[model samples]
Target: MLTVSEKFTAFRIHKDDNNKISSGFEQLSLEQLTAGEVVIKVAYSDINYKDALAATGKGRILRTYPLVGGIDLSGVVIRSEDPRFQSGDKVLVCGAQLSELYDGGYSEFARVKADSVVNLPQGISLRDAMALGTAGYTAALAIQRMEDNGQVPERGPIVVTGATGGVGSFAINMLSNIGYEVIAFTGKTEQAPYLQALGASKLLNRHDIEIGTKPLENAQWGGAIDNVGGETLAWLTRTTHVWGNIASIGLAGGIKLESTVMPFILRGVSLLGINSVEMPLSVRAQGWKRLASDLKPSKLALIAPTTIKFADLPQAFDAYVEGRVTGRTVVEIDASLD
Candidate 1:
């Protein structure tokens, strides 16, 4: 158990009087953390595009200044006012508004709201939990939502945009493991082998495919898990087959939707928005349950190949921000806890 008087290392983000964003490691005590019922000895946290944005000031990710900057964490509980958890329980928190509404996981110890914590599901290790992080979790949520909306392998191939990214990688693997033919839509066609290993049946290079200007083009995909928005998403809406579901996960390309409602009305195409945050606890629990069982990525190691020490965290964000990274990078805060 961590004593209240002990100082722990935390990566904190702050905005100054001049409104410039800055972040770095600092020593912090338990009382300095935001309010929460569970105090965890953080074992692992993973890097996401959001984490990069927060740490580098590339995007506005924090609603409060001087907050710790990790959105996903896996750890062991040391103290809990919540009846659902107790000391030594393995747990995780993802997309719970950490770093935005409260101090987050990029610390040796994290105090998180009881509602935000999850008992780490069986069949996945604490390390594996962080390896999945929000990226895999979001991918699971998207797949679950698609299936719930009546999507099946018989519907035809599911096109996963941003296929080289963490979410896309996990989506491809999980979808394929469950017998869905997965088509990877990516700009980096050179990563064909990598995508193929993740169970993509085919690859569609974004640069080569002429995105038709018609309101609805010939339906090419049964459904899609879209990470890129704007033209790519518009293309998905137009090209998806009848009764198909398009899970809109990210807006890496652009947020504007210029397409008409032709697909939704004419073909019964459903556009499901996949927001990892703000999910009900029941939904969150079920998603993690699936992630541990049926939806578990068979190529988990391949998708998240990098694990770095906590001290190396600052140097890792640039690759994510610059879009030079592939797969996820786990930040090992205390591997001994695992």
Candidate 2:
């Protein structure tokens, strides 16, 4: 049995007085963790683009030093002051300022606000929740918002950019499962079979999407989930069907949006900005419930996901930074903790 006196290991990022940053596993007691209303014995944590940025110091993701480096974690609550949680309650934490303003789930344990944690919905296991992680949650939120904007499968095909990445992959799978004709835009044409198995009906190579010099183009897709911003997003803005919804989620390509208001003013295009980090608890719960039910992929194991141990995190993070990793990666922090 675990005890409070024992030390736990966590992958932490630290900066020296000279401002040089470094990261690795460190031993720490519970008292050293960020104060929270609840404590969790972490079982699984997943890698997202932001997590990689925080871990590698490649992006301005971490606001504090000596911080745990995971934005998504799943575990059993070991202690709680909140009336809603108790010992042995399965819960998952995604974003909510994790790995930024507070300690996160790169450790065998995590301390977080009770309000930031959500009980695992029925039909989704702890591991399964981590498998979906923040990427899947964000994709589901985008879909939900698009549906609210009158996007329907019967209208036309939905396009997903960066289709091989985490959010794009989940968006394609969920949109396809929901009966939409899903077209995937990817740079990896060789991964066509993988994208097809994920339910993408058509595959467009990166070169296929032109950054035309026009304010507007012919309408194609009825809706789009864009993870790759910049030119790709500008292209979608011009070509999306009238009244089409475009959920702008990531800036993997570039943050600068160079597009005219023609698409919005003329076609009634709706561009939604998805920020998962500060999502409200109620909205998070709804997304998880849908993930546990209608949006759950049948062959989630087929994402060709990679599972790594705690010690392998640094290397995994490097792979992600180099653009070598695709799909989801679950970090098994403690097999026994599960």
Candidate 3:
């Protein structure tokens, strides 16, 4: 059987007295890991907004200090106490309190709970899984649930808020690939053509509808896959067509929801909450299966990360936080052992 070796470089975050996050490379040992049933020789990890928050200590994403700060990781399993996984099994762990209660995938190695592991389906590379990452998973989950709830191509157009971000971009592509007319919403008007290339039928400026704190407003979109919280969510909830379901996933804008019950009570609209983290293993596997099947975007390979070596993690994390980064940013670890 294979094993995790000694002294793997990890992107470590240390919180100071002021709660400022300071992240850099540090050598870690298996003994430093929190308890789990399996150990992964991390092959790839992509930067997400949440990871940016933890890396920069901007949003209180991590519950613990001095932890590795990555929420999504894909790699080969080296050791396992669980029957479901074995050595050489390619797996992925998203959410599950990594970068919070435990060290995460921004490392050459990681130990994760067996329950959090999802065996990669055929045609999905371990590295591509990181490109899809947590953001892509959540986006796929939203689209899946929406379709499961009777959303279809005839439903005018689907709205995707935060279109330039990871989740929104992937959502647009997935929806488009599956033949849904998608209307992307973003603050970045300059990215309109780029989004269109990913199958956005149209684009909506954020300042136009998502700015106000109105309780409710005009109904516009037939369906929605919303990642931006706060007014954006509220706006989408109000604007969604009757019986339309909007999946609320991320809280990038803000978590506060000050909306009237009119959309739900009057229009029969539904706000489905999406929690990719702590989701049941069966559900996660199902989501992955969906990703492998219908929800896999045609342009997925284009959004693949710009791979950087482990030593560049610190600067990469910083760039990720500063919003200068686009698409996925993958950290490449030593793959020889795998």
> Which candidate leads the pack in TM-score?
1
Q: How does model 3 fare in lDDT?
A: 0.83
Residue range with the least summed lDDT across 10 consecutive positions in model 2: 1-10
Candidate 3, which segments miss by more than 4 Å at Cα? 16-20, 210-217, 335-338
In each prediction, how many residue pairs overlap at the backbone (N, C-alpha, C within less than 3 A)? 0, 0, 0
How many angstroms is residue 55 displaced in model 3 relative to the true structure, after the best TM-score fit? 1.9
lDDT of 2 by residue, 104-204 (tens): 99998889998899999999888888888988899899999999889998879999999998888999999999899999998899889989999999999
lDDT of each: 0.94, 0.88, 0.83
Mind sharing the TM-score for model 2? 0.97
RMSD of each: 1.0, 1.4, 2.0
All candidates: TM-score: 0.98, 0.97, 0.93
Distance (Å) between predicted and true CA of 61, model 2? 1.0
Evaluate model 1: give its TM-score: 0.98
Evaluate model 2: give its lDDT. 0.88
Indicate the residue-level lDDT of 174 in model 2.
93
Report the Cα lDDT for residue 247, model 3: 93
Once model 2 is optimally superposed onto the true structure by TM-score, how far is the C-alpha of residue 60 displaced, in angstroms? 2.1
